[model samples]
Target: MATEPIAEDLAGICVDSHGSAIGMPQLCADWIPNQVFWLVIALVVTFFVLSRIALPRIASVLAERHGTITNDIAAAEELKRQAADAEKAYEKALADARAEAQAISQKTRDEIKAQLDEAVEAADAQIAAKTAESEKAIADIRASALENVELVAKDTAGAIVAALGGSADAATISAAVGNRMKG
Candidate 1:
């Protein structure tokens, strides 16, 4: 029962469509001239606005943006050039500093070497003097020891001869002592 009444209402809607607007208004033959005139007016007005106002403004904005990009690129290139120059200067300064450092190091080394040589020479001179003094003192001590040995030997020999009831002459003892001291 519900489907039958709905079907009747849908059929009545189609039959009553002739008394009301149903299809697209623009496709009607009775309104063709008026729609054409309004469409042409709208198209002409849109074209005029886009070409004279909106398009020119948009074009100017694009040109300004392009100019800004070009300027930025040029500025970047200039900065790069400046950076390269700074790097070169830095390298040169570093090289110069290194050279100066090397020169100073060499000078310092030479001075140290000269001082070392002078000190070595002074030390050697002092050693030579001390060695000569030591040699002279040793020679004097050996001579004094030899003289004391000779005197002690003579005294002992004289004492032994006297105890044995035989007299040994000083000259004879002296000759024997000299012969033995030769070794």
Candidate 2:
């Protein structure tokens, strides 16, 4: 008597008199409205949770990531620009340094050339003076040697004449020696 009402209620909902389900529970017409109502409630709750909580959090994270990426890209571009500028400056400086070095080298070469020219000129002047001095000395030596030779010849002639038992005149011997030397 106590279980009879419970069995009747269960039979009308999803079970037969023996307590087995009447058909597929999902397709049962008696349960369709309740299932549909609860399904709609669950879907609404899920939609609200995603829209109000999960989606916003996901959107914030995505936005933050996008902002970070954008900032990194901008910074990279700025650094690239700076690097290019620095390279240009470095190249300019290198060119200027090379030019300055060439100028300095040329100036140094010019100074050395000038000094060398002056030294060469001084050496040439000294050589010319020494050559003139040497020529003058040679002329003096030749004059003295000629005078000594003339005296020796004259003396020899006088001795030869005396040895031959003939009187020799100094003036005549000198005159004869001078005439022979003229040729």
Candidate 3:
């Protein structure tokens, strides 16, 4: 059978020399030194782990990551500079091509203009020659018509004189007709 707690046992455990409440043994001063000793040991082990192992690894990783980011940014800037240079080169080449095309166009125009001027000069020469020939032909036709008119006038005069019973003189009629036709 279990023995019941006696009065002596309860009295001895409930009251102590100090006026402190009774609870867990952790509240007692006798455990203070042992708790302090364990606390110090835990702190030393934590410092060693952080400083020698975990913190150095994290720091190295951070440093490596920063270096990678910086290198990537630097590479991007270099690529941008190269792109700008390429654009400038393209613009320069385009300008040069345009200038070359303009020069070619100007040269073609000059050559065409020279040919046109030559053609015009040749046409003018031909027109002048034809005009001179036409003028000479007109002069010849006018001279022949003047001679035919004189001969017709003489014949008419001779016929009229003979019909009036007068002497028909060819030389006299010819002389009179020539004098009238002078203007």
Candidate 4:
């Protein structure tokens, strides 16, 4: 059986054509330090950029949002104040209307009272006039009755004297009148 000869270069250091070592297991072991250094530099750069640029912009935006919130709160408070003022105005108007209604009611009551008083006065005057007229009529009737009584007495005395065949004297006429009055 035939086997191929091993090359010496496989176990020895390999070099590039420019005389630079191309492969070193030791250099490959040191690559971890270089990668660590570059990672630290990248982290620092990222931190500076965020602090100087992006962070400031974000802070400004947040401040603007806070200002907007404050302004909105102030506007809401103003609106609340306006609403309260409107309610107060409405209450005042309602009170005024009630007062006016009360005044009107009082005036109407006063007018009614005045009218009632006037009517009462008129009724009293009419009653007084009617009473006076009744009294006057009663007096006249009494006078007429007295005159009729006197005439009747005279007639009775004349009849009595004719029946008895004697002359009627003043004394007899007066006695007849006295008897009629007693009856």
Candidate 5:
């Protein structure tokens, strides 16, 4: 019975006379063509799956990312331009405000100076009027004092002549008093 042929199954090909494995089954010549055929089928299936499904999805995702980056850069440039314009406008407005402020200050100063000048002129006019009035009053007082002194002197002289019993004329006493006053 030991010499009779053993029935062969898929697992029996690599066995020896005592049913022990010979070397490695994957390296056996009998199974090499079957392994190579299955490897080619697996590689073809993997390539089709990547090309039809996985590769297209990855490419679309990369394209979307690139478009987003480009749009973001464009938006940033536009904002930068707008910022520069706004800065220019702000500077111009600030300069205009400064000029307007200076103009207003100058105008106010001129108006104040004009009002001060008018006030000074009015005060000078009032002082001049007061001075003229005071001079006229002094002149009037001096004239009245002189007339009073002359009257008193004439009365006193007439009294002295009467006391001495000289009988002086009124016209002669008046003429003498007038000559002394002229000197």
Candidate 6:
């Protein structure tokens, strides 16, 4: 019986708190309706603020970034093009230099060949001239030896005749030569 009374009291308190407009205004009536209106207003204000202020700023920033990226890409392309041109120019110059060097080397080789040929010709002529002079000298020596032999023969014949008291004739000289040869 006591538990039944306490239960009734608790039930009464629960009904008063939940029911509309007796002590305090009903919990939902006091704030929930007003809160709903304020929530709608805040959402409308947030939409306007985002669309007019924040979203435009974000879009402009994105557009500026895109423009900057495009400009950077263009500049990079220009630099790449310039680099390619420079490389081509460098290759052309290197090719020209190699060609020029080959030409110079060929010219130098030709000049060296010509000089060698001239030097060979000059040396051959000098050798020929010296050979000719040596041959002439040998001929002169042979001729001189022959002349001396003839002169010595004449002198020896006269001496033999004088030594033999004028009796030595050609036959005697011949016999003497034969005897000398035998000895």
Which TM-score value belongs to model 1?
0.58
- Candidate 6 lDDT over 9-126, as tens digits, reads 4335323433323455355354667888999999999999999999999999999999999999999999999999999999999999999999999999999999999999999999
Q: Kindly list the per-residue Cα lDDT of model 3 for residues 1-183, writing each as its tens digit.
A: 125344453334433434334675666666679899999999999999999999999999999999999999999999999999999999999999999999999999999999999999999999999999999999999989888878888888888888888985788989888888785
TM-scores, in order shown?
0.58, 0.79, 0.72, 0.62, 0.77, 0.67
Model 4: CA > 4 A from native: 1-29, 36-53, 169-183
**lDDT of candidate model 5 versus the reference:** 0.89
Determine which window of 10 residues in candidate 2 has minimal summed lDDT: 1-10
Task: Point out the higher-scoring one by TM-score: 1 or 5.
Answer: 5
Best by lDDT: 2
User: Model 5, 25-65: lDDT tens per residue?
Assistant: 66777888988999999999999999999999999999999
Give the worst 10-residue stretch by lDDT in candidate 6: 13-22
Candidate 6 residue pairs that clash: none
For lDDT, candidate 2 versus 4, the one ahead is: 2
Q: For this target, which candidate reaches the highest TM-score against the unseen true structure? A: 2
Write one digit per residue (lDDT tens) for candidate 1, span 20-53. 3445554556566878899999999999999999
TM-score (C-alpha, index-matched) for candidate 4: 0.62
Clashing pairs in 5: none
Task: Let me know the TM-score candidate 3 reaches against the reference structure.
Answer: 0.72
RMSD of 6: 8.2
Please report how far candidate 3 places residue 152 from its true position, in Å.
1.8
Count steric clashes of candidate 6: 0
